[model samples]
Target: MSLPLMPKATAVWLVENTSLTFEQIADFCGMHALEIQAIADGEVAIGITGLNPIAKSQLTPEEIQRCEADPDTRLKLRPAESHLTRARKGARYTPVSKRNDRPDGIAWLLKNHPEISDAQICKLMGTTRPTIQAIRDKSHWNSANIKPRNPVTLGLCSEADLEKALAVSQPRSSSIFLVRASEASALSQPAAPADTGHYGRTEPQDAHSEAESLFRRPASPAPAESGTETDPDDSADF
Candidate 1:
């Protein structure tokens, strides 16, 4: 049976730009929705089948170039070689498949916001400070090759939500009021005792003594009465 003609690009574009549901598109292409989804996710081969055929030649050279230039537009694309292929090349290599290529938590934090500190990243990811430092060092974790899982893709947060989180995670400068040991000791010491009259052996002065010292007056002499008595006697004789 001859296969029907359908371009992979057309299918991909339909998935992205059309209002039609995946099921509808799958039905139109005479394929299962899961198949269409796989094609969209770059997890399956998209080509002509017994009932469905891909019309790749239908796209203009410019359209093909555009698709190649934009990675987002490319569907059903895979890495050039698998780990097995690399091993066959006779080069000693670690199998990329065995390891998580995803960036360490700190790398993700730094990539998203260049200004973020290691401590801040550690706090945000709930990871250790040393782990964050190791990620930043690029010794064990190569930031350039590591691909971070998008928070949006993971459904952990939206892009806007991440922005807010970054804002909240920023280190705030705070003024700490610290008291020196000497200053604290000075403040804690008891006040000196009030001055007393005894020399070399000071005693606590009473309130009365304090008041007298604060406010005291000198004594005045009594006035004479002889001159006044003589004037009264002269008046009685007259």
Candidate 2:
């Protein structure tokens, strides 16, 4: 579930402004009931300002009233606004500690993924074209000390954002290389030979019968012809 922007502050507001029990507020804020009780007892968040979830469109007044009426029920956060209709915003903010590491991330992107465009780098790293160019040319103020590092490892950009940027910034040459590699792989394999019905010890039935008949012995001559054509060589004794 999407949470209110400042949960502790919202808990403080609920505790100070409403009579809802600690459990309800804790459930809504994703905090422990004992922690809410500590806030109620003035043991935690001593001087923090409370943020109104209702004012921020993160909660509804009617939902708050229903939860106030029933102590056992949990509070639900309002549904998020659709990004499809939401207007695009400016560049994201980088923390003070991580600002110096931008050059390292930029240099890494330039070296490793030169196909990525400068605009994509800017959007992903919260940097500008000049900074990217300076880093690429080794002309930045800290170029000497800057070492290429992953923006994700440095906490400068998310993996999702990096993937999205890569999708948008992929060079045409890389695609051409992929296509050529696939074609080469396809051409290297030999084609399979066609299947023939003839296999081991197999032939037409008519041809097999004709071949067997050719090997048959000839029939002996009749005994009557022996008496008319007897010769001295044919008799057993002369």
Candidate 3:
């Protein structure tokens, strides 16, 4: 039998764009709703293995074949496993109570690095605005009364601070990854001009003109009669 054309990206896109519930999507994609939720939340990484036997009815030949063909591609297509399930199956996860619940380090970052705003701190810490505020407010770690501490001392500023420091200290250089010497070497060589003919002009093209040209074409002439004569009734005066 011919295979169906369903893909994992399409499935995820449908889930995001459509109002379908996890259960409905799970039923449609031959996966458990819980598993689908976990995948959506990025708690677990999906694998190439097929869904439970109960969900096999939803599997199409194309999806199965694609899953089997590539392990990485198949992972994208499958639902994520639950954290509880993974842990039960011997996967390690820090317990909620033990999960470094304190935000003192974040507060230290904000207080010491006054130049950086709460929003900047939030982006650097990979957290929400409210969470950052909570840290600043000392709601989580009671850091308001805490002693003077730099982000480096709290482990929140090393990576981000290094980059910021480099940007401020160094001249306008191209290579952000390598040392100054390497960047200077790279800057010495000039880059070749890009070929613009194949891609049209570098400047923005007029959308209206492009669309009009695409849809509009010259009309074709009508074909002349060969041996057959035109009917008198059909003939028109020139």
Candidate 4:
């Protein structure tokens, strides 16, 4: 699906030009409501030049009005023949000047958002896994001079894209941890009644008994392998 170009900028325009709620603006612009609120409060996107969606033919004034009239309604993008022409997907292009800053951006992502995997970084930054690995290992050619800088600030990617990438990566990580925790809980449980049987019959063991069985120590060592003679005094009890 086609999304608004420069979504943050589009959101800025929406916030400044309309009375739409942050949720509505966020939904239309593919951003967090909090981020949209931040834009309205001038806490972020401070120096960003707003790009008018209507002026760019990405939206119509009527659409904005319709959404404004109904707080629950979402703004829709205006269909354009140009969006169809631009459907070809390929590796993203970085300008020659901005290309050198990728290592810094990669380093920033690695240091700040280590929860995101190498593959997610590759997708978000339009960089290769090898490059990300090198940065993580401090083995990149310019490692000495590399500094952690936001990829959005470096112009390597947009904030909206970064947020979306993080949203995708984090849920999967949480789900994996949840699965592992559930498996661990399952393993910790005592063997079932059917499992405790010697001949596959149901022979239940109580919780305390089961735990004791698992932790029971070995029997006292056999009497010196039936040695010839023990000192008579050694057999005397204290």
Clash counts per candidate, in order, are 2, 0, 0, 0
lDDT for each residue of candidate 2 in 118-207, tens digit (9 for 90 to 100):
877888888999999999888888888998977765668755577767877666548867999999999998995554445744443577
The regions of model 1 sitting more than 4 angstroms off are: 1-105, 141-145, 155-161, 169-238
Q: Which stretches of candidate 4 lie over 4 Å from their true place?
A: 1-88, 179-238
Q: What's the ranking of the predictions by TM-score, best on top?
A: 4, 2, 1, 3
**Candidate 3 residues 54-167, lDDT tens each?**
132234455545544553443223332211121122222333552243265455556555455554555444456777776655574454555434333333433334356445
TM-score of 4: 0.43
The total of clashing pairs for model 4 equals 0
Measured over all alpha carbons after superposition, the RMSD of each candidate to the real structure, in angstroms, is: 18.5, 15.3, 30.5, 13.6
For each candidate in the order shown, give its overall lDDT on alpha carbons: 0.48, 0.81, 0.48, 0.80
Q: Estimate each model's TM-score.
A: 0.28, 0.37, 0.24, 0.43
lDDT of 1 by residue, 1-238 (tens): 2112333434555565544555655644566789778877867654422211122222344544555465445323222231112112222232354234324434666677765555544434445666556666776546567555443333222234456556765543211113355678889999987765567665536788668866878668787766545677788998
lDDT of 4 by residue, 52-171 (tens): 777567788788888888898888777766333242266667789888898999998888887798877877777898898888898888899998987775668765578877888888
Instruction: Give the TM-score (vs. native) of candidate 3.
Output: 0.24
Worst 10 residues of 4 by lDDT: 80-89
Candidate 2, residue 211: the lDDT equals 78
lDDT of 3 at 48: 23
Off by over 4 Å in 3: 1-102, 141-149, 156-238
